[model samples]
Target: MMNTDDVVIHVKEMLERASRPITEECCIYRVPLLIRQLNQEAYTPKIVSIGPYHHNSLHLQNMERHKVMYLKSFLERTNTSMESWIHYIASKEPLIRHCYSDALQFTPNKLVEIISVDSGFILELFWTSNYGTDDMYLSLPWFATTIFCDLLLLENQLPFFVLHDLFCLSVANFGNNDIPPFILLTFGYFQSLNESICLLIQCHHDLRSLTNFYLCGENKTTHGEEPMATNSSVNKWSEAGIKFAITKAMNTGKDVDILVRDGIMENLLGDSDAAAERTKRLCRNIVLSDFQF
Candidate 1:
């Protein structure tokens, strides 16, 4: 409906805007509809929502009190003032917001508050789970199990750096040197899920990124000539004179290397419930990466 002059002016404005520097790339993403549709509950958080994406949902409101309780305990144990915590997280607001894929509509103060409370709760929860009294919340039947599973959900994650910053500050304040590394605590917490999948998380920024190490592996390249895609199961492969031998070392470093030496396929397999799911998802991702899904 506009004239040529108006269109030209609008195009020029758009081009100018596009030329500005992009401050952040999207890191968080919604689970693809295809994946979500397959298992609606798996991707959904049952107990808590950690970031702006799923913050303050009606069903998740019960956990809000728990978060506050944990925060209070954290403050008491660390003996650190709340004002200092706020200032530290407030300084990292822009960087933290950039971790999410979408623009957070909350005010800067609200965003800082969310990050501070959530990160504090998580750090405290981890510490308590490892070293607290036997009467803590984790002692509830199936409570720890459900919460650990919820934490691993994509939508129920806080940026790992936020957690690390708070943890370091707390440790510095309390002069406590006994806390284990975050990755080790996390792996220990969820070890029941997959003991065989050795997680070597280095320089990861979030739980989702850490989990990807298990699902997709470190390397993308196929080890040798790509196996021909055929309608063959492991049993069928065995019938075709292919022998399957389980590898002893199930390291993340060798996750994607499928070896075929002398008609033997040295495949990797895990023996836990979580490992079974990871194996299926890993194969699906590998095929999808090859443009075959």
Candidate 2:
């Protein structure tokens, strides 16, 4: 049997032999098998796939043509050629692939194709949702909400830089007297999903923090805050007519007092009661990992 240090050396050497890099830029991740097994539908995309992870899933295919249609509209409206964008994306091949935790099996060209169209669709979404549109997808409230939910999923994301670069690239094309920062536009996209929910983040002011709430979905547990009840316990409490309400202060981190939050309900769509249970269960049987922002 190998001794402790020998075993450690062996593991290190094996990692070196592997092609995967130390992904410091790695933020996007596939939902772990254990976590995905919790409630598959909550994490999986139903309406649209934004990134390479679920790029051509069969059920998600129907939205493909719509993405292309949105891309076409974006190009025509901006009169921006795809050639420059393609070159820009192609040059970032390694960095883009590194953003996801796993190695991307896609070819360089295929990866660029996926990012270009998907990012274009998202930028167009930010535009139409704010600027006004008669587009069929944006018009249907339910479908629009589903699309917004998918955008927030862990696996369904392009790197933030890719999105920021494209947003800046298309800014002048919009011919705006004043264009909001990309971070604000992103929050505005989330706000548009539910007119009832207002993301009053203007005063918070850090670009990084503003994007963290939605982009990464990293619910940072505070020093004293945590789950006092298990999944079954939370469900039982709700069943006993113990209604959970928003904290009067409405501050950060998990407020254990309110077991189910609108933030959770919005991301995991379902029947009201069912949504609450599912949201509470998200923390059950899961240990927080150090590998986060």
Candidate 3:
């Protein structure tokens, strides 16, 4: 639409505004629409809208009020001021924005407001779930389950650095409450979602590594050693004097009732033929990756 000189000027201006290369700071992202469209419900948050992606969805507005309530509690309990937090977060705007994959449209003040409130909510949630009394917003059974599930969706995320910074800032005020380190608290909060949580101690920053450990039940590679993959069935592994640390287990009633916990099969009924029949069908119609799905 322009002449050569105009084109040159546009290119130069664009180069001047180019973003820094992607680094560790970049983690949050929007799911590709191709992937999301296959099962939009699976990717969408049900209760809480975290970060900027689903920030102001009308359906998620209910949680917005709760976020403010949490912020208020966080400020009151620590005797800190939101004004100061907002100002501090404003200074880190560029670093925070870089963490997200998209170019957010919110102005500086709006972005600061969102970051300060969301970060405070998470910090308060971690603290209260660990140290506070039995009575709190999280005590609501349905709300607790739904909100936590929402928090784990890939799109509903904030950079870990922001949460870590807030934790470091306000942790000293927890005052001998016996709160463990921020990472430990975070681990505890999400432990229910991952049975092989012990591996998280070493692989917390690497989702792929953590997922590998989660599915394989052990590290595929150890330091000073070569990469290796091994497979052993649950019954065989258990028979070999190996015990697994599982999140939960259950004994099903008689008549070949299968036991499941959090979508995972925990135990089969003691009837050998019935259990065998069920186990035989476990892989039916499943699209196995070269590795197990």
| lDDT per model vs. reference | 0.64, 0.68, 0.64
lDDT of 1: 0.64
What is candidate 3's lDDT per residue for 144-163, written digit by digit as tens? Answer: 87877777777887767667
- Quick one: best lDDT, which candidate? 2
TM-score of 1: 0.70
Question: Per-residue CA lDDT of candidate 2, range 34-148, in tens?
Answer: 8788888878898899889999799999998888888878777777778867888899888888888877889988999999999888878887887888797567989997887
Worst 10-residue lDDT window for candidate 3 reads: 247-256
In order of appearance, the predictions have TM-scores of 0.70, 0.69, 0.69
Stretches of model 2 off by over 4 angstroms after superposition? 1-17, 173-177, 192-273, 287-293
- For model 1, the stretches where C-alpha displacement exceeds 4 angstroms are 1-25, 134-137, 200-202, 215-231, 234-293
Model 3 lDDT, full chain set: 0.64
Q: List the residue pairs that clash in candidate 2.
A: none
Better structure of 1 and 2 per TM-score: 1
Task: Sort the candidates on lDDT, descending order.
Answer: 2, 1, 3
In the range 129-189, model 1's lDDT, one tens digit per residue, is 7676454565685776677778888777777777777777767876667766776666655
